[model samples]
Target: MMTKSDDEFLDDIFGTAKAQPTLVPDDLMARVMADAQSALVKPDGAPKQSLFAGVFDIIGGWPSVGGLAMAGVAGLWFGVSPPAALSTWTAELIGVPVSVDLFGDTTAYFAETQIDG
Candidate 1:
């Protein structure tokens, strides 16, 4: 007959405890999941929003809508009537001479000459 040493016997007992499967009741897990789902809240007790309404809320309600409208108007106004100094100011900032006229492009020529000198 073979016999296990004291250390081997202790190790076998502890190893079985480590390998044992823990059984949780199915109803307990269901109750836990339900509690978790209930804990994830919707703001102001409101029900779910439609897709468009959700997008509108994500874009920050009314103020962002007004700002977007104003930006569109400003872009249209600028495209129709550009300021005269816009050309000279852009020329100075870019370190080149530019004519406000778009008929014959020569800005690249001036830029190359200035860069070489």
Candidate 2:
């Protein structure tokens, strides 16, 4: 079930199951040994926590709940107020007065100009 050509091809790829020797320069070898010693010198062998965890810890320990209170006030204002409330607020902000009455017929305070060429 084995072919000679396949066996030779496998041997060419895997180097006939023999380990090849490696060569290293004396100066480069000394430098590599020094670097390995430095890499192994951990203070207590504990893994350092990432910067993301530190940021999350600070945000989680924030002292104020002002944001939550503001959100609740905003929700209450939007839910209980009428749609006309926003328009009246805008008019008041721009120094204009607006009146709304069911019994009174509404009229434009100013006349519209008809442009004729």
Candidate 3:
């Protein structure tokens, strides 16, 4: 048995390959061109939104805005005055004593300094 060279193999494959011309209907070509043109062109007075506005649009718009606002307000409230139950639970979980003072010794030290001055 004789082995064929790489060039001979490729030549045999290409020798059987034939070039064929594809014919598309004129109306189909016209419609395709019209669609391509329409996609490339933008309509007049179309307002371009900023990145933030685009993100808000994708997140259900006004409802998402209201949700974000509510979350921020809730975070502010929790930071100012966290519930005693929450503080106690956290202290117990961390194996630490729950002090009655919210600001701890830092606030007391600052108050004493102000009084002395």
Candidate 4:
């Protein structure tokens, strides 16, 4: 069992106390308010940046823009020229002369093999 004086002692030792007042001088408050008011009143006569300038800034800042451009050019060149070269190279590697007749003249060779009775 605890005594009343012990409880009172604990309260006096560990209880929450009221905080002291924080003081702000009048001159500092006036200066801060004046600065804020000046920032709020910007001059509309200032020159604005163009949309093109903004886009250029973004594209120029991107680290991978040059890499992307190079990849695009390489992709376009490969797209236009690779499949035909690959087919020709494959045919040559397999020991056959690869001939492509795009206007359908190669079908004449097939007509010569007629049906026999």
Which numbered prediction scores highest in lDDT against the true structure?
A: 1
Q: Rank the candidates by TM-score, best first.
A: 3, 1, 4, 2
- TM-score of the candidate numbered 3? 0.40
Residue-level lDDT of model 4, residues 1-117, one tens digit each, is 889999998777665443445689999999999999878855795578799777867777466577788999998987787787776887788877658768596566566655331
Badly placed stretches (over 4 Å) of model 4 are 1-46, 57-61, 76-117
Superposition TM-score, candidate 1 onto the true structure = 0.37
Task: Look at candidate 4 and tell me the lDDT of residue 104.
Answer: 94
lDDT of 3: 0.85
lDDT of 1 by residue, 28-65 (tens): 99999999988978687767789999888999989999
Clashing pairs in 1: none
Clashes of each: 0, 0, 0, 0
Global lDDT scores for all candidate models: 0.86, 0.72, 0.85, 0.76
In model 2, which runs have C-alpha deviations exceeding 4 angstroms? 16-19, 42-117
For each candidate in turn, give its C-alpha RMSD to the true structure in angstroms: 15.7, 18.8, 11.3, 10.2
Which model scores highest in TM-score? Answer: 3
Candidate 3 local lDDT, 1-117, one digit each (tens): 545787788777787675445689899999999999878757675778899998888998998889999999999988899999978888788978645867877988999999999
Ranking by lDDT: 1, 3, 4, 2
Clash-forming residue pairs, model 2: none
How well does candidate 2 match the true structure, expressed as C-alpha RMSD? 18.8
Worst 10 residues of 3 by lDDT: 13-22
